[model samples]
Target: MFKILVIDRCYFTRTGMESWLNQTDLFPASFLVAALHNLMLAKEHIVQWQPDLVIADLHGFKNEIHHIQQLASLFSVCGDGIKVLLLESGEDAQLSDYFTQFNIEETLLKTASLDTLAQSIDAIVLSRPTRTEPKPAVPLLTRQEEKVLTLWMEGRSNQSIATKLSINGKTVYTYKRNIRMKLGMDNRFTPFLSLPDAIN
Candidate 1:
């Protein structure tokens, strides 16, 4: 079962996102945090819930793009397997390049229809590479591992991952090390650099 955390500032928006996720029939469970104030609380929420991915609402906040990048970086460094799906308005479309630089995945327009939203989520969560030619087999990841890998790909820090996984920081490091070894990314620099591709 895949678990997701929905973060948004407005009550109505947060509820709407959660409803949409529940309606998708994909995720087994979801944790909702509306009007998130402190970054520490966001970290704590991840640790407590250990969600597979995060759907972050980037609207109506100061330094919205920067905050999203910070969260993305935190998830990447940590061993949490969380991917961020940004919810943006048309006005914010200009910030796409900024998000790309940070390796944040795709963005969802705030005004998008429910069907469009569902398709976007499905694309992100259930995509797989097609086998048209001979290529190295992608590692098959367990649901839990995928969650951790998603966050790792987002550039969360080790301590952040530890908190999200409710495990010791060292344990987070060990999981990452093991993941790298299993994926044949055991080299230090290689693991860090190829992590995004490995997880995705």
Candidate 2:
């Protein structure tokens, strides 16, 4: 499910956007939305919830330059995989820098049609490559990583593996992390298949 955060002081606009997106065919049952009024409060929510999309109205924040900059900084810091859609009363040249610097991709006038809003969202959300369940496949491990995994499975300590491999202990840990990522395993102890027969 995709999480959406709608930020606007105007209750009507905030909830209205939420309702329209919820009912629209673009998401239908896919969106989990949270609407808020304060930009400061929204910062806390953004850090905790990490919403996929944020639809915010800048009209209410036009007078608060610090708050606007703060909002932009918040996004710039932890905004990976997040899409922002800004709604403004008119084109504010001052905001162009914030938009470019922070990677805020979409900006629409407050009076824009819902269709236009939907199109912007469509381009942002639908164009992203959807993540699917990982399938079992032959893991492409480097020779060094395979050696580390072999020693790891034999219950060798990181220090022992490092000594045997003539590498630093931290390098052993790095190889293990890479191995787990390649296998899509969450923890060091998760059970996974052995190396393919071709490698044996």
Which number leads on TM-score?
2
Off by over 4 Å in 1: 24-38, 63-80, 93-95, 128-200
lDDT of each: 0.54, 0.69
Q: Would you give me the overall lDDT of model 1?
A: 0.54
**For model 2, what is the C-alpha lDDT against the true structure?**
0.69
Model 1 — which ten-residue stretch has the worst lDDT? 130-139
TM per candidate comes to: 0.48, 0.58
* Clash totals in order: 17, 0
The root-mean-square deviation over C-alpha atoms between each candidate and the true structure, in angstroms, is 12.7, 17.1
Q: Which ten residues in a row have the lowest lDDT in candidate 2?
A: 191-200
Q: Candidate 2, TM-score vs. the true structure?
A: 0.58
